[model samples]
Target: MRCQPRYKGLVYIWLKNKQSCLLCNEPADGTAPICMACETELPWLGDHCETCALPLPAAGLTCGQCLKQPPRFETVIAPWTYGFPVDSLITRFKHSAKWPFGRLLAELLAQFLQHRFDEALERPDALVPVPLALKRLRQRGFNQAAMLARWLGASLDIPCEEQLLKRIHDTSAQQDLKAEARRKNLRNAFALAPDAPIKGRHLALVDDVLTTGATAQALARLLMEAGAARVDVYCLARTPKPGDAT
Candidate 1:
C-alpha cells in the first residue's frame, strides 16, 4: 500500500505556496515567504563562538567549553538563536506537523548558508541529517532533520545523504537532561550506516536546533573516527547559554 503524506490535505500545499509572511501574515516582500520587516525582526544570531555558534557577548571569540574540550565538528552555522517566533515556529513545525513553517525556515537558512559559502566557508561535499530513532520517527510521522536537509540540499544544489547516519538507540530526549547527562545519554546512540562513503568527505549535519552540542559532537566524532575529513553543523537556530536569556 502507498503511504499517506504526514500532512493531510490541500491546505499543506496551499500553505507551502502561500506568499504571506508566516509571522505577520502580510504579503512577502520578495521570493521568500517572509517579508523584509519580519525577517529583520527575527532573532538573528549575533556575535557568537566561531566554532560552535553559541551566542557570545563579543565577536570572534571561542566559548570556554570549546576552549577546554574541543568538539569534533569544525564549525556550526546557525542563523538565529532559539528564541521568540523562531522557537514557536519550530515547535509547531516539529510537533504539530506544520510543514509550511519548516519550509520557510529551511528556505531562509539555505540563503544564509549560501552567503557564508560565498564569503569563503567551505561548502560541504554533502549534507547529512542527524537521524531520528525509529521509535521517535514512528511517533512523529516525520523526521524534521531529514526534511530540512532535503530542502536545503535542493536550494543549495548539494546532495543530501539522509541515510548516512543511523540512530541506534532511543535515548531519552536531550532537553530534559543536563549537558553532561546529554553526552552520556548519546553514548553508543549513533552509528554510521553500512558502506557509508564518508571517508575524506566534508559533511555538514542538518537539524532544527542545537542545544548542548551533545548530539552534534557524538555524530561528528563517529564520522571522524570512521574517516570523514571534516564535519560541520547546519541548523536553523542555536540555543543560548543555559540560564542566560537571548
Candidate 2:
C-alpha cells in the first residue's frame, strides 16, 4: 500500500522562498537573507551589564567600570555581541559601503527594540545619530550611524534628528586607543546644534557599534548639558571588554 503525503497547509506554502542566506547560501526562511539556523548562531548578546551593556556573567547587574564611573547615558541597549559575522557585517557596511548589510542589521535592531519597548522599555522621544566630523563626512560621503538611525526611526515611529549633534573635532579613530585615551580624545569632540530643541526630551543616541563607549559618553554629556531629560545609547553591537572572550 502506498502512503499519502501529509498536507502541511497554506502557511508553509506562503513561507516557502527561493532566496539564499547571505552568509551560508542556504535557503533563507524569511525576508532576511539569513537562514534560521544561521540566525540562531549569530552573536546575540546575553547576560550583559545594565549600565553599559558589556557582556557580564549575569543579567541585571552593573559592571565594575560602570559602577566606579557611570557613563552619561542612562542605559545601553545593544542586541548583538561584536563577534563573528556581526563584526564582519558592520565593517563591510561602514567601511566598504555594503548598504544591504546595513539595512539588514538595522531591520534586526529595530525588531529587537520594538520587542523591548513592548516589554516595559520606555521609548525615547527622539533619536540622534552620532554625527561625523565634516572632514570625515566629506571623505566617507555618508555616516553609517545616520543611515541606521533613519531606518530605525522610520520603523519605530520615532523622530530622528541628524543635525542635533555636531562633531566639532576630526580626532583620530578611536579603534586603537585605550579606554582613558579614548575618553580624553573625545572630550570636546561633540557639540549640540545651536537651535536644536532637545530640552526636556528623552533622547536616544544611535550608533553602529558600542566599543569602549567613549563616543557615547561624550555625546550624552553634551546632550545632557543642552538640557535633555534623559539620554540613552542604542547601537547594533557591543564589544566585550579587552582580554575577555565572548
| lDDT on C-alpha atoms for all candidate structures | 0.93, 0.89
- List model 2 lDDT by residue over 112-180, tens digit each: 999999998889999999998888888888999999999999889999989898888898888989989
Q: Which stretches of candidate 1 lie over 4 Å from their true place?
A: 1-18
148-226 in candidate 1: lDDT tens per residue?
9999999999999999999999999988999999999999999988999989999999999999999999999999999
Extract clashing residue pairs from model 1: none
Give the least accurate 10-residue stretch of model 1, judged by summed lDDT.
9-18
RMSD of each: 2.8, 9.2
